[model samples]
Target: MLCSDLVAHYGLKKSRRVSIQESLGIFLLYLAYGCGNRLVQEFFNHYGEIIHRHFHKVLDVVVNLSKDIIKPNANFNETIPEHILNNPRYYPYFKDCIGAIDRTHVKAYVPQRYQIKYIGRKNYVTQNIMVACDFNMCFTFAWAGWEGSAHDTKIFNEARRRREVKCPLPADGKFYLVDAEYPNKKGYLAPYRGSNIRYHIPDFRRGQTRAVREPKGFKK
Candidate 1:
């Protein structure tokens, strides 16, 4: 469905110069493995000139279609699902929790003048992307294009102010879960701070024999 929409939007038509399938193949290969222009041309067994032209054309199409492709789930309503509500570990305490929000860094290429701004503490150029996922482990919201050096709180504030990402507004005492990096605001909930405090599930499950044992209340 998405491919068809992009093809139609771009007015792409098959011809001896380059078929739509070949164009899509080249685009997917370039993105999937982050191959350089020369490597991609070699893989397709095409001359530098031909591959270079087609690669940029396909990239332009994909970039233009991203607004439609990378959007929030329409069904999201800031309500916790039954599966999460029924789980002993999450229920009661997190009954009002609907989803989790966090940021991840993806390597990026930038001009020399701006490289320092994009270089993070890890000493690499990257883009800090924020994502929010629901209980089903599906992404509900995403905001990309932030500089790697930008703090998580800065990105969240900018996203909220500009509404670049459609994070559902929490109501009826519901809120999205966030890490300590984010503030404990009306729409976001954060764990308590302090040393020796383990609020995450993995923290409690680590090196514990009970985590490997079946629950005593288990039933077929």
Candidate 2:
């Protein structure tokens, strides 16, 4: 039941080499166990003859199919839920916030020569992945393939270079929420620095609390 729904949602079709169900099954198994080829084959109670090769083949097919549709290269826009729109308690920034951005590394074993360049300073051989998530926490953008040594700020700059987010920052001051690894650049906001603590509100308040907090230099 769920498999059919997923296939329809993902718009996957029967490949020339395999059935849609089989491909879906391989993907599910990968997500379930995060196992290597041999381990995945063992989990499926099969030898290397069939399922192992098919798993990778299915992955390649799906990745190619999904490449264009996965990430939308548009600037952030407000698509606030009906309930949240009417609630004064919620921060108005929720509507203006384009997305939350972060980077992570996926560990892998590669050749020594490759690992020399790929392994990060922390000594973990990893592939760096950066992603941007909308207000709903769904990924709207992702970039993978950089080495783990790549910094999150560098990844963001590169993402900008790709011309994906071409829209200008909002005139009324829209911004992005990013981690400490990112700089407090224009069009993006990070936590207030210790040196600049006097300028920012320690905690944003709502409703009557806003009135009490407003006079103390927390006004938006």
Candidate 3:
């Protein structure tokens, strides 16, 4: 399992009071349930400091894993994906396509002075995370730590400039499918922008109906 891999490679050791499994469990619970150290302490019968320390220790290693685990396939340059080659619908047109790219907001709690920069369209504090993934649902690249208010195009532009995570670049004629928010550049594909055409079915239904008893010309 991943916990065992962490022990073997990442330098996380077994504690005197608990094994690596238990310490990792405490951290996972804190994240999964969004509970505090006190709640984890009550469940695991460990001190708050121990809980906090173990959580950070696990986090440190997991972040490091991104360098290896979240990157383009080693064979990406040499061969086309089987998913595209076998599917007649995408075989010819998308043969040069590599993967999909997008961004999302991850909830964040920053210092009060910096909170304004973290407020997203959802009106919540978050960090905008950009990612690219293959058709197999495997993440090929990830770029994180941007403020939530940052635009997707802006984040991608900056992420591509950084050397460490600047990979998964399209080779020659290859491209990755991105949404309308990203530019349809040399190595990226995006749909045409049209205000009259709704991308999703739900978007077309939005604001098209009202209560039958309401006045005909009522706005809002």
Candidate 4:
């Protein structure tokens, strides 16, 4: 059904030699099987070299369509959902929290000269992607395509400036959770420098069998 909808929307008419359905099938198979172009050619033997050309065209159509399909639901005025407000672990402190923000590195390929810009401390080429997700595990914002060597704070500042992924300032005493990598500014809350709980979790797990003790005066 989705494939048919894409065909209609993109006006991907069937060619004299190969039908639209078959062309789409070749593209999906390459993705689903994680196979190379040669392997895909082997699978669709009848289409032969034609699959190679059609593959990129269909891929381009899908990439263009994804801009609308894969964006955050930017509803700033919406109140905290009832489900999050009722949860014991999140009720009081995080009741005002809208979401969590973090960055991760994803492997990427680039030209030799440009590869140096994408290389991070991990000694690999990657794209540093910033993602914001709510308690419901749904993404509220994403800022991607930054160089892997870029700092998280720098990326966050740029995203805010460009309004590319507009993270609305929290109103009515609400806020968003972020790690120490970000500044403890107006709408964003970060953990304390020396007493961050994440730092203690690994050490706590190494020696403990029973309930782990909280770090001195660590607040929930």
Top-scoring candidate (lDDT): 3
How well does model 1 score by local distance difference test? 0.74
TM-score of each: 0.75, 0.60, 0.80, 0.71
User: Please, what is the whole-model Cα lDDT of each candidate in the order they appear?
Assistant: 0.74, 0.63, 0.82, 0.74
**Regions more than 4 Å wrong, model 4:** 7-23, 45-67, 71-77, 164-172, 195-197, 200-204, 207-220
Per-residue lDDT over 1-220 for candidate 4, one digit per residue giving the tens place of the 0 to 100 score: 7578778786566777777888899889977987877787777776456987888778877755654555545564367755577888767766778877888899987889999989987799999998887767877666668999998889888877875445455676778888667877888997765423444366577753333344456777
> 150-199 in candidate 3: lDDT tens per residue?
98888888777777766578888888999667877898998755334556
lDDT, candidate 2, 1-220, per-residue tens? 6447446554556655667677667777877877667776666665565665667656655655445555534544545543446777755746566666778888866778888767886688998887776655667666777888887778878787776433233334566777667767777887654422332244333222111112224435
Clashes counted in candidate 1 amount to 0
Scored by TM-score, the top model is 3
Native-referenced Cα lDDT, model 2: 0.63
Question: Residue 104 CA error for candidate 1 (Å)?
Answer: 1.1
Q: What does candidate 1's lDDT look like per residue over 20-131, in tens digits?
A: 8887778888879988888987888877787777877787777556545555456455545877778998778887777889888999988889889888876899999888
For residue 6, model 2's alpha carbon misses the true position, in angstroms, by 10
Find the 10 residues in a row with the least total lDDT in model 2: 206-215
